[model samples]
Target: MDFEQGSINISDEVLKEIAFRSFLEVLELSADDKDAKKLKKNIEIERTPDDNVIVNVKTVAPYGKSLVEFGKKIMQNISENIQRMTELQVSAVNVSIIDVVEKIEPAEEEE
Candidate 1:
């Protein structure tokens, strides 16, 4: 008699969590902050029956020239990182600009 063990199965949820954590590391985000962590963030991941992965990421950025450049840089970095790190074929990484954050003004101190 011969017996064979089944291969390990990886769930999509697990993959998404892994991807999200990786995103944080690549983006240099504060992973220590539970609220700031991508995995814990409002991002959503969907997997098609054909094994294609789709991710929609919503991020807030301050309105400025540098911030615009940084946002673009972040998007590129995310695409590259996902491809390099995951075995699952990524169908697309869609970024939606839902909100713009204004720069915070420093409060004046009274002597």
Candidate 2:
């Protein structure tokens, strides 16, 4: 998708939220920083005057997963969604792995 004349302007925070939510749908992962302030540092959005945006996402993936393929999926998902929603071309989407988290099992109730 593409836009001309710059009729619309979107906030960086909104882009970040879009990215964060998109990532969650693509994979089983968690962001390193849960707080809004810290999250800002993890997700970066660079917007060009031409309506092209570059997104950077840092996250903790589920253990035992392939980082390379995982990152690719994240980038593809974010880029596609952004273009579909805002009609803005995503110049690039970068994914950074901060750490990997183990899946915790729930305890069984007494029978």
Candidate 3:
């Protein structure tokens, strides 16, 4: 169950889970209708010709927030967290906003 050379292989599922968790921590994402494992198809991880890792993420962002900031934060956080946790150099973190989660508030009664 162990390799003599002490080398380890990280699977796509693991990376997806890590990326999902990192995205969730950004506070700008909607937890509803989001699944790291189930949405594995939306996440793609591959090694570039230079051997650097690239991650593609597709998720829903919370409405009313700055989409630009959201993308930047998601990419930054994902890349940093993934590299830190997995020890894999992430060349890029691509985020595709699939939907927006908006909370509609009820209007107050007029006095």
Better of 2 and 3 by TM-score: 2
| Distance from true location, Cα of 3 in model 2, Å | 8.7
Candidate 3, residues 1-111, lDDT tens digits: the string is 137878787876788778877766774334454332355465678787765788887766668888889889989988998889878889999988767677411111001
The true-versus-predicted C-alpha distance at residue 35 of model 2, in Å, is 8.2
Which is the winner by TM-score between candidate 1 and candidate 3? 3
> What TM-scores do the predictions have?
0.62, 0.70, 0.69
- Alpha-carbon error at 11 in model 2, in Å? 1.9
Residue 58 accuracy (lDDT) in model 2: 78
RMSD of each: 7.9, 8.0, 8.2
Tell me how far candidate 2 lies from the true structure as C-alpha RMSD in angstroms: 8.0
Output the number of the TM-score-best candidate.
Answer: 2
Query: Under the 3 Å rule for N, CA and C atoms, how many clashes does model 2 have?
Result: 0
- Put down candidate 1 lDDT per residue, 1-111, tens digits, no spaces: 112865554566665665566556544566575445433454567877876677766655456646566556645655566556665667777665555556421111000
Worst 10 residues of 2 by lDDT: 102-111
- Candidates' lDDT values, in order? 0.56, 0.70, 0.69
**lDDT-based ranking, best first?**
2, 3, 1
Give me the overall lDDT of model 3: 0.69
